[model samples]
Structure formats: C-alpha cells, structure tokens
Target: MTLEFDLFWSFRSPYSYLATPRLAALQEEYDVKINVRPVYPIAVRIKGFFKQVNPLWPPYLLKDTVRIAEMEGLPYAWPSPDPIVMDIKSGEVPEEQPYISRLTRLGVAAAEKGKGMPFLYEVSRIIFGGVKGWNEGTHLQEAAARAGLDLAELDALIEKDPDHYEKTIAENEAAQKAGGHWGVPLMVFEGEPFFGQDRISHLIWRMEQKGLKKRS
Candidate 1:
C-alpha cells in the first residue's frame, strides 16, 4: 500500500519553501502521496500572533530560515512582495490581503487538479528563491506551466466558485490545528504530527518503519 501524508503549508512561510523540495523528492522516489493542504499564514489566521511573539523571535526566525535554506542547499530569500499584508514593526496583519488570499485559493485549485506538489514547489521557488517581482509579469504563469498546469485555468477554477477555494483554505487551517500544530510544514502521517522543515527526516523515518519503498 502507498503511504500518504497531509502537509499543512502556507505560501508565505519560508519554512514551507524550505520543506517543499525534499517533500517533492520523497513522493517521486517513494511509493507515497502528499496531500498538500494549503493554508493562510499565522499572520492572517491567528489574530495578534506576531505582536504576541517575543521581540527576538522575528530576527531569530530570519537567521534560522536563512541558515536552514543554506543547509538544504536550496536558494533562499524572502518573497519580493510578501504574500501577507502586514506591518512588520507593529506585527499587525491587515484585513485586506490581496496576494495571499489568491495564492492560497489557487493552491487549493491546483490540488484539486492533482498537481499539488509540483505546483507548490514551482510557485514557491519563484516566490522565495530570490525572484524579484515574482508576482508581477508572468512568473507565476511560467511556474504553473512548469508544473504541468496553466495559471489561467487554475484561476478560472477558483473564479467558478471562489467560495469553494476559500472554504478549503479555511478547512485546511482547522485541520492543521486538529493535526496538533498550527504551523506550516506540518506533516501528519496516520495521525502523528511532525512539525517543521527540520522534522521531515523524522517523518521519513516513520514512513520507512512502515515499509516505504522506492518506486519502480
């Protein structure tokens, strides 16, 4: 039987970007499937989350993510235009988030089309891999094409019933919390949660214990 896991991820998360490439590799190399459950970032999902965080947390996070990306040998940088609309200093997330809302919804649309992993990996690379103005021009369009999907088609899917996509995003957030972590890169296999990009090894270990095998 093929093992499967639900990956609760966010487009705005650097860790999610860091985790994606290896996750993509895993599915190709092993007989497993990844259900990419895209969710809004904590900045939007949890009110006062950033403000409540320790003042040192932000800088530490920046330092940690950069090092992790380097360790993983994946190109890394913050998104050119951050997906979330928020004030960094005050840690205030605005209600009107134009970028993340669409991205997260489109993630659901792609997943519905069975192109979740590739779509996530490709789009995220464009966003977090130092592409300037990643959202402008045809960066996303090109990324979608590389993933065997079309950006316009996915956008049209969302437009058909945007509420459907929004509902899925919200449901993913709820499932993330129920899966025992409100964090991105949360991987849950058979109800066990491994949270963080660093925890991907642990997840693989568990999968191997359960007889995971390389694909033919």
Candidate 2:
C-alpha cells in the first residue's frame, strides 16, 4: 500500500520550517509521497491571530523550537525581521496580510506545475532557515532557481492564472473539510489529520500499524 499524506504548510511559521527536514526524510525512509500544500499562515488567514497570541507563546515557541532544531542537528535561526503581519505605523495591531496571500498564490502556482514541494522547501529555507532578508530580489531569485523553477515563468503564471491559484486554495479548503485543523507541516493519513513536526514520528508509527508496504 502507498503511504501518502497531504502536508499543509505556511511559510511564515517557524514550526513549518522546522517541520520540513523531518517530513522530507519520512518520504524517503518510508517511501511515501508527501503532497506539499502551501497555505497562508495563521497571521494571514486569521485577522488577529498574531496579536492574539499570548506574549509568552512567541518566546516559548522560539526557544523550544531552537532546542528541537539542535536535537535534530539542522541549521536553525530566528529570522531577524520575523515573519509576522506588521502595522509599521501607529504600532497598533491590524491586518496587513497581503504578503502571505502572494506567497500562497505563488505556492499554488508552483504546485500546479508539479514543482510545489521543491519550491516550498527552497523558499522556506530562505524565509526560516536563517537566510537574512529573504524578501530581497537576489535571495528570492536564488531560491526559485534552486527549486528548479524559473522566476519569470512563475511570476507570469501567477499574474495571468487566477483560475489555477484559486483551484489550489480551494483544494486546501477541501482538505480542511476532510478534518485537517491546523497549518502546514500537517499530514493526514487514512482520513486522520496529524498536525505539527512532532507528529511525524507518530504518523510513521501509525503507518506501520496500517502495514505500510515498502516500495517494490
């Protein structure tokens, strides 16, 4: 039997970034295919999600995630500028979520061309894997190239392909309807949704229980 699952991911979430290496390895070790589904992070999807986060939550997650990264021996760093919805002026919390919308659209566009997973991994590395100022042109272009994608082509596709982008978003929503309750780095196995990087091992264990057949 093929052990496959959909991985819903957010570029802005550190957890999502932290989740990739393990998720990728699972695909290799278990010979399963992980469908990389990119979605806007909570900050973009929910208007006040960032502002509503408990003050302690950010620092705690940051520290804990770093420890986890250390344990995994993967390169990790907290992006200096941070990937959050910002209200630069007034210092008041408000929705400035267009950034993630663009990212989600791009993600969907790449996925449409069967390049979604690779594109996301490269992009996430720049965004969360400690590359400074990922928004700059050079970094973005390099990430695109590394993923075997043409920057110009992806841009054009996103600009002229509303139907494709909308279809990707619709698919994500449909997956949620089937019971995925959280952001990217989530995998659904046998209709059961598993969220977070910590759950990957558990997912593998479950797949074993279900008699995941090794590739022939």
Please name the candidate that would achieve the greatest lDDT relative to the true structure: 1
Which residue runs of candidate 1 sit more than 4 Å off their true CA positions?
Answer: none
lDDT of 1: 0.92
Error of 2 at 125 (Å): 1.0
Across 148-197, the per-residue lDDT of candidate 2 in tens digits comes to: 88877887888897677867777786685576586656778878988888
Which model scores highest in TM-score? 1
Q: How well does candidate 1 match the true structure in TM-score terms?
A: 0.97
Name the TM-score of candidate 2: 0.86
Give every collision pair in model 2.
Answer: 8-184, 9-184
Report the backbone clash tally of model 1: 0
